[model samples]
Target: MATIKDVARSAGVSTATVSAVLNDSAYVSPPLRARVLAAIRDLNYSPSLAAQNLKRGRSQLIALVVADLANPFFSRVVWAAEAAVAAWGYSLVVFNSDEKPEAEQRILSRVRMLSCDGVLLVPVGDSTKHLQRDPDEKPLPTVLFGRTVEDDKSDTITIDNISAGRQATEYLLDLGHTRVGSITGPLHLTTGRGRLDGMLAAMKSRGLAPEPRDVRSGEFREDAAYSVARSLLEQQDRPTALYVASGLMALGAMRAIADLGLRCPVDISIASTDTIPGIGGLRPRLTRTEHPLVDMTNEAVRLLVDRIRRGGEVEQRNIVFQPSLVVGDSCAPVGLR
Candidate 1:
């Protein structure tokens, strides 16, 4: 609880001399420096780093707001972001909105109150209005990660969702599956809508379309996907293949398929857009389009840091990374096995 003044008084020196020794900003005789160091140790005095950062108009903190922390996909994002932020000399503050816009609003408000230097956000809403703290003050430095919204100012780092969908569906089609279905995320988000659109487009290109009942929204949730996939597979004329929109949802679907006593690539084939931490170990490893999650997170942090340092003078940039198809035994050609 000792202040700099207390250290200076104990050291028998002016507070300025104490500060000089602490900051190493000015020359101090060895004797005076020794006294100051001794006083600091005896008094258990520690300077306030938050106060010092504030005086320089920085918090040395960056906020990373993800839509769903329970999802392993976002957990990977957090891991990558932590290292990327630290490499730039900033600590990371994490928040999970759980895919709720109200929670997103509150989290962004808290970020503003904490005066975070920048934000890397996985947007949960259709707009970025919450990022603007005050009409008079400038907008916070922000980079939207893995998603985009109705914001023109912030930079965006995203995967080609449409390509992800198209690639997965094309893989299924190439394997000779005629009746292909999909379990998708909420259609309101770009990740959901774009992937579904790509699936439909790929089907249309092959002169085919899914039945209205064949596609279901899984809300990007494991439990929801489990229920939906169970119901879809219970039908008498279910599709032979399913294109799951996300890795988490795919896990749920896989579990559902097992619960129903169905085997992958035999009774039904499954392909998905993203991959999670343990997905590689699944029997008949998932046939999916994999996003560069670590690279995307690093790029998002990089853009946010650039915006924080350069302010609005820098041009807004939207960077899109492509997904690569990783083939595995989860999918098999129809009538071949």
Candidate 2:
């Protein structure tokens, strides 16, 4: 069991000098660095992991917390972030908050215990206060992803959910879908509420009422959306077109429509968000509001590392990217309607 003391004793230098060398601090001279390396090699003195971590002030570890990993969008974000983090010589600790603020906060506490450099969080808005270690100052550099920072709170990196929602609805509108319904995610989340706002804005612009009955709420999951879509179809009259909150939720809605022997853009039309890679391979490619999950992840890691370099620096910044729509097989113009 070799330690810093042993390395120093063999090198005939102070323990401080050995630390400077092992941690790759620039203060040590080339001669001193060479001597330390020589001694470490001859003595087979392995640097203590705990000592190194302490000296570096960080274990070169980061945390990425998201709402749902099983969802394709979340998975793509995690993948992109992990790749970018590794390039900066840091490893990532992944956490699935399961859309629960309590779970996200619990993971944040554990990250605090470790020598973590920073965190990328997609918060559960209603319970977001749970993720805050300090109301005024953050205990670690954090980037809020796909979510908004609490008023004057953490830094943020988000896709324009509102714009995305607006775009989805506008696509339907351009196709002459005047009677449109929406299956929205629970309004407790910023993404959910923001997207819904966009939908309403588009409707209002067209001089239409954002009908209360036309919009129903569901958890941002497949099953919940599926059930809602089924209920919409059971009514005596249904919308000519529907806009769903998330891509995964959209899949469920489509399946429900299929079970009732309805057709897309023929019997009914769909415009929604989130498109997994698998969607391209579907017999009918899905039209969608496509967020740049990978790009957003890269930016989040970049911002976190910059903040970490400044030692948990304070800066209130928000990066919001707009999504684009892909007009695929799922939607059609209303001329045939």
Candidate 3:
């Protein structure tokens, strides 16, 4: 293993000169720089980037913690974050908490141990206690993505989840769906709760309400949505339309409808919030509200990088993007064939 010392000795220069040449932190004479380069090439020396970054008080790595990586929506987030992080001259490190608060805490602990420059989190728990900084130490630069929690002071980048739910439900209502049902995400997280609230508000404005049996809550997972959809749709008096909360859950509901031999927009109409990769390829071409995924991710990275460069003196910011409804073939008028 050739050290900086070895390279310096071979180049007949002081260690400081070798360090300067390697880091390009200071100007070196052309001849001296050429000698150092020759010595490095002959010795096959590679400087430790981790050590160099540490000495500069930066890891040059940003941590991204998502609730469920298996979900295609989050996978898309990872793809966008990778590009955006690279654009900001930082590397991204990903972590999945699998929607468990304990797992989220453990991942945050690991992020601290790695000395990640900052974090972009999709919060799973009801509070941000695990992400709190020490009193004496500087606050970790963090931006909560997609969701939020209680007692949180960090900057946030999120979608208007309530508007997402309202838009999808309103679209179905405009299509003359009166007997509407829903398959909801867990009622605890902000994304889940706000969306459901929006759906209910939209329904109330139309002088309608869902039957108790028609509203079912499940995890933001395909399998869970499939099971819940199957149970909800199998009822003798099922609603004529459904408002699903998430894209993956909508896929599950569509699958369940297929297995049950029910045709969408005919036997029952479907509308949902959010869309994921390959969702546009479905036979019915799902009608849903779509998020500005790439734009939101880019903004999140920009805010995180800004926070990292300028310490925590700035006021906390909460940026929310709206969802736009994309009409497709899956929905129809209440009595349309």
Candidate 4:
């Protein structure tokens, strides 16, 4: 319970000198600085973060809001973002919106109260209405990550989800999978809509139309995907190959296939849009389109920090990363079985 006053008294120096030494805000004589350090160690004194932030006129805290932390993809993003922000002498506060717009709004409001310097948001859907600031109020320095909102003024860092979906579907098509099915994320979000659009567009190029029953919404939830996948697999004319939009949903679909006594790439092949940590250890390694998550996280943090430093003077930036296809053992040619 040693305060700055106690340390100052122990060091025989004024409180201002102690503050200057602790914060590195002003140069002190070498002897005085040594005495202050010795006193701090002796007294076990710790500077108050609130007081330090107040004196500096900034909290040096960044908010990172994600749609779902339970998903490994987002968890990896959080890890990388935390490390990136730490390197810049800032701390990251993570929030999960559970893919709800209202929750996202509430979190943003809380960020304002916490005096956060900037935000890195993965929006729930295409709704940027919640992000609109009043004309008199300064906009929060934010970088949208992993998802995009229409007409948003904030910087954005995302992958080409449509191209990712198209590539996954095309790979399956190349393997001669004519009756391909899909478990898609919610259609309201750009990630979901763009991916589904890509898959359909790729199928159209081959002069094939997907049946309505062949596509189902997983809402980016594992349980929902499990149910949807189970139903799809039970159909009399099931698709020989299945394309899943998210890594979490893909895991669920794999579970459903296993529960039904079906083997991947033997009865039905599977490909997906995302590859997450530890996914390689699965029974049948998933063929997937991979996002550069660590790179994207670093870029997002860098953009947000720059915006925070430059305020309105910084120009908005939109960065889109390309997805890479990673071929695994889960997919095979249609007739191979």
lDDT of 1 at 106: 96
Q: TM-scores of all models?
A: 0.91, 0.90, 0.94, 0.93
**Residue pairs in steric clash, candidate 1?**
none
Prediction 2 TM-score vs. true: 0.90
C-alpha lDDT (0 to 100) for residue 138 of candidate 2: 51
Model 2: runs farther than 4 Å from truth? 9-14, 24-32, 38-46, 131-138, 312-314, 335-337
How far does residue 192 in candidate 2 sit from its true spot (Å)?
A: 0.7
Tell me the deviation in Å of residue 75 in model 4. 1.9
Comparing 1 with 3 on lDDT, the higher-scoring candidate is 1
Model 4 per-residue lDDT tens digits across residues 44-159:
89988898778776798999999999888889988999999999999999999998889999999999889899999999867677765576788888899888888888899989
Q: Where does model 4 exceed 4 Å of error?
A: none
**Please, what is the whole-model Cα lDDT of each candidate in the order they appear?**
0.93, 0.83, 0.92, 0.90
> Clashing pairs in model 3?
none
Query: Tens digits of per-residue lDDT for model 2 on 183-247?
Result: 99889788888889999999899997556787998988889889999998778778888899998
Error of 3 at 4 (Å): 2.4
Candidate 1: which stretches are off by over 4 Å? Answer: 1-46
Between the candidate structures 3 and 4, which one is better when assessed by lDDT?
3
Worst 10 residues of 4 by lDDT: 125-134
